[model samples]
Target: MADRSGNNKKKVNQGATLKKVFERLGKYRIFLIFSILLATVSVALTLYIPKLTGHAVDFIVSRGNVDFPGVLRVMVQIGICTLVTALAQWLMNVCNNKMTYQIVRDIRNEAFHKIEILPLKYIDGHAYGEVVSRVIADVDQFSDGLLMGFTQLFTGVATILGTFCFMLSVNVKITVVVVLITPLSFFVANFIAKRTFSMFKIQSETRGEQTGLIDEMIGNQKVVQVFGRGEDVTERFDEINERLNRASLRATFFSSITNPSTRFINSLVYTGVGITGAFAVVRGSLTVGQLSSFLSYANQYTKPFNEISGVVTEFQNAIACAQRVFELIEEEPQIPEPEQAVVLKDIDGNVKIEDVSFSYVPEQKLIEDFNLDVKPGQKIAIVGPTGCGKTTLINLLMRFYDVTGGQIKVENIDIREVTRKSLRAGYGMVLQDTWLKTGTIRENITMGRPDATEEEIIEAAKASHIHSYISRLPKGYDTWITEDGGGLSQGQKQLLCIARVMLCRPPMLILDEATSSIDTRTELKIQQAFAKLMEGRTTFIVAHRLSTIREADVILVMKDGKVIEQGNHESLLEQGGFYRHLYESQFAH
Candidate 1:
């Protein structure tokens, strides 16, 4: 029963591997046809070489003379054939390389697009390094295999069949002797390929994990140093490095055995063929020319077998890589855009959430039976402890993830009824983790609406209280920023984010701990900008600082995914409830 099960699994894996390879190649059918034709030409050229040598031998023995003219004619014919085959081979290589590059480009683009549209849950579940590894290492393997292994596999098969046909025509008895050893050689080659493939798969997976670990270590280098865990980190990394070394060694060792073993088998076949041909000659069944031709054919046949073994090994590695790449491409995202969805238009930003419930995992509910209503132009504040689902609320509002239950409406329309792009276009956001690409300050601020005029950009920056600072720089608004805006201070980065949001000028605005990273003085300046920006826009503020929310028209204090207290700031204080307790505790310090 166990053996049956293992056989079934092996068959399934083989089918899947083949399916993936064909699917990848389907886009390059034209190139594949050209490749096959070139391979056929190359094989024909190789087989003709042995026949030409046979003719030369026959001419020398039968005429008892060199037959220079006949020999020269054959040489010229072979040369022409060789030239045509070489040109065809070059064309085949060019097409194959083109196909490989095009396919890799498409796969990388698709992967990046999928990453951009994937739901937050999907991203949260994966490591950044692993995701990056899929884009780089795995895709590169597919490219290498497509360009190198695929061409070799087809060409080797053609050469093998062509050589076999020529050998059989020369002498069937010697052909039979050579064919007898093929099965054993095949079995040994397959066994080595299987072992090598398993090791390569392990190597790829471990390499991805190690990449993830290294990315995490670099991202949190400060944490490592602060906690004095550098030595511990080093030890952990060493363990991963050791595993990688072992996997690489195992893979290389198995792969190294394939070529030598194949060559040895070919050598044995050559010896057997030589002995059998000599016996046939002595038995009066073959002439000296026939014996010489048989030896040449035998040698030619072994060349293909040797080439085929190497090609097969490479194909196995490529299949392993294809398996990983297909796994990623086949994954269905947690959230997908609806077909033919309606696009929202002219939204006034009156937002309402009714009995909304959500959870990253099904069992651990983060928000349940939560409700809220914000009239147009109203400022709403949400207060909660960490993990109380404040950001989750914003995520649902932005449709990053749909609500697990209940309904969220924007401008009197169910958010799900509108297209995702339209739904997001109605709102502007300033997140705690502000990101800035490498570009001029003007470019970053005008990213969302590039067509915005220079005057409009400056206006938005002024509204966010960042224009003065930018104007003072040597390059002014054109000052270049490094990736993640490294030259800017944290407060400055946040201000730039605000400036960007202001340029968008959406009807609804969300500030998620926007001032949490700034000092008191900078926070005051930001708060002033926030006051001006919030005017006439429906705004949602999420903050731990009570002072930030004290003036809100409506305040909702939440705990354990429930809205435990709701009222205006003064009314909530008078009630001396959860909101009042939070205010007292937070401000009393």
Candidate 2:
């Protein structure tokens, strides 16, 4: 089922969105003003052709009594007008294209910048695909609508005004007839447009959901197949696709009505002008040439009404898409880093977690009144059951999440008082979930210390036990990989991540299940490397594998977010507590 609960509540103020769009357009006001000026010249010259044609018709007062020179002169002028009109329109379109794309470029840049500074909680709460759709898909949709409006909407309105002035100059009676029927087209288009906006908004949202679902399912297809969830996911996808289909149909059906309906009204305006002008010709108040001019003006005037009506529907859809794009650009970002914040340098790794309290949600407590202190070069291993806040503790220590109460200090300086960039630079973190950008293997390894020597890159890879595998590749360390490290096994990706941290060799390190993916033989080799790497560096290891942390200087075993046991491997076993039970259970199996 569609998420229809908030259908009536507007997601964004349309007025605000439009105002923002105009504000952006204001940045290129020179181009916009130039385009409009060209459009006016185009319309004015095109409208003048009808008057010149009327003059050409009047020159042929009576068949062979025709003044060929006068007719030829008017014909030349009409031809010149047509040529200039085409040139002006071409220039106007060029300006429109340039301005439209520049606006889209600005919007995309700002949206990406906003995503970079958004709080982690915001990212965690929304689907990755949904955010991607807004930046890529939604902006593209907005671009199409905007381009159409710029190309057609401005000229259509201008033509309508120009035609009205030309028609009035010929005869007021025929001009009034054209003007009277024009509002009928506007009324019909407005009625359809009002209904289509909501449908189009819903359609855009459904499309975003569809994009998000496809992204998630495709990215994790292996897990889906392992769990036999192909049909289940398919069924869910069909439901969303069906909703998008229905929304698109409704929006398209209603917006589609505006074109033919306005054309019908415009046709009536043309008919009325013909009939009224014929009567005026018979009464000698209008010449046959004047009647011909009025009929042409009627067609030109009414034609733009049809065009404008069509563009109004497109404009509605554009506004709906712009609302989504603007919402993303305006999402609450991370709290600003303070001015005069201390930049951590030459740091001794002495971490102190004071009476800290935290929870993902205020209503449900997770970790409360937690405290821990570590001296420089201490190897602190955290062991806990699932949901015991082991990863959360790491998040706090890295200042990815600040403690709700009290504070955490590095080198006795409160972490909040220090610049996050300089503070985070002091620690090297290797997580189980490995991420590699699309680049050569050497680039991935040297990500942390790009200035490292070729020998240092090889040394870090060799230390992490990945040099052998990398050396076997066709391109050696120059081998290209994707963001997800395509064609590489999970263990290989983890090894690369380890190599990244190894290359940095910061004063503090975090290894959160860093060796989880490697085989036992490789794990042992990497552990030996880690043993050397941990020397004189404060390291926090979050591990479920009890045997791996046996040599930790202190083991903090936790349950329900509180450390239940605080001791080393041998003493914890002697105590026969929760730590021993957890340790023995793994071996017992």
Candidate 3:
């Protein structure tokens, strides 16, 4: 029973691996067709060579002399066959390269598109380096396998079939001697391939882990330096590297053995065919020309077999890569866009959260039966201790994640019923961590609406209180920023983000700890800008500092995942609830 189960599992794995390879190839049907045509021509040329040589030998012997005309004719025919094979080989390579490039391009584009729509939850668990490897390394392997392996496979099979038929026509008895060795060679090659495939899979996985570690170290270099944990990181990386090295060595060792072993088998077959053909000629069952032709066919047959073994080994490595890519592509997205969704138009931003419940995981709920209603143009503040689901609330409201239970509505319609693009377009957000792309200040602010006029962009910058700071720079708004805006202070970046949001002019706005990193002077200016920006828009503020939320029309004090108190600043203080305690603790300082 155990043996049967293992066999069944192996069969299933093989089927899945083959399916993945075919699916990737299906994207390049035109290239595949051209490859087949080239292979056919090449195989036809290969098969014709033996027949032409046999005719030349028979003619020389029958004439009982060295006939110069016949010899010249035979040499010319052989040359023509060689030229045709060379041309076919070249065409096959061109088609193979083109197909591989196109397939890799499509895989990369699809992976990138998928990554764009993936939720923050999916990204949190994966390293940037690992994601990059999936796009580059894994996809490249799939392409290499499909192009090189498939080409060799088709050409090898054709060569074998063509050679076998011609050999049989010359002498059936000697043909059997040559053909008998093939099944044994095939079995040995397959066994080696299976072992090599196991090692390659391990190597691929270890490489991905190593890549992930490298990415983490680079991303947190600052933290490592501050904590003096560089030695620890090095040791950890060394461990992963050692494992990868061992796996790679094993894969190489197994794969390397395949080619030499196949060559040795071919050599043995060559000797056997020569000996057998000699005996047949001596017995008067075969002519000298027939024996020569049989020998040529034998060499042709074994050459492709030898080449096929190497290609098959490469194919197995490609299969390993395909497995990783297919796994990523098959993962179910955390949040899916709705079908037949309505596009939100002219949003008035009347936000309502009706008894919403949410959790990053099933066992640990982050928000439970949370309810709130905000009128258009109202300013609501959410104040809570750290990890009390403040950020999660914003993520849910933005549809970055779906609520576990209940509904969130905007403009009296359930958020899930609206297209994600239209839903997100109604709100402007400034996150706690300001991320700036590599571009100028003007480019960053105008990113939300590329079609906005120059005057409109400048006006938005002024509204965010950042126009004067940008004007002070030598290049003004055209001054380029480094990746992550390395030249700017945190406050400057935050102000830039505020300007970006202002340019969009959404009906609803969210400010998540927008002033936490700014100095007091900049904070005051930014607060004034926020006040002006929130005048006629529905705004949700998540503030750690109590002073910032003092002017809020409503304050919701939360603990764990539930709202414990809800009222205006003075009203909540009079009630002497959680809000009052939070206010005294934060503001009394």
Maximum-TM-score candidate? 2
- Residues 1-589, model 2: lDDT tens digits: 2445443344346677889999999999998998989989999999899899998889988856999999999989999999999999999999999999999999999999999888788888888898998999889988888888888887888998898888888888778878887899989998888778788889989988999999999889999999999999999999999999999999999999898999888889888988888899999999998889888888888888777887889888888988988988899887777887999998879999989899989998888888889999999999989999999999998888878998999999999999988889999999989989999999999998999999999999999999999999999999999998999999999999999999999999999999999999999999999999999999999999999999999999989988888999999999999999999999995
How many steric overlaps are in each model, in order? 0, 0, 0
lDDT of 3 at 215: 80
Give the Cα lDDT of each candidate: 0.83, 0.90, 0.86
Q: Assess candidate 3 and give its TM-score to the true structure.
A: 0.93
> What would you estimate as the lDDT of candidate 2?
0.90
- What ordering of candidates by TM-score runs from best to worst? 2, 1, 3
Cα deviation at 560, candidate 1, in Å, is 0.8
| Candidate 1 structure lDDT | 0.83
| CA lDDT, candidate 1, residue 188 | 79
Q: For residues 430-449, what per-residue lDDT tens digits would candidate 1 score against the true structure?
A: 99998898888888998889
Candidate 1: lDDT of 534?
Answer: 83
RMSD of each: 2.2, 2.3, 2.5
Best candidate, lDDT-wise?
A: 2
Error of 1 at 227 (Å): 3.1
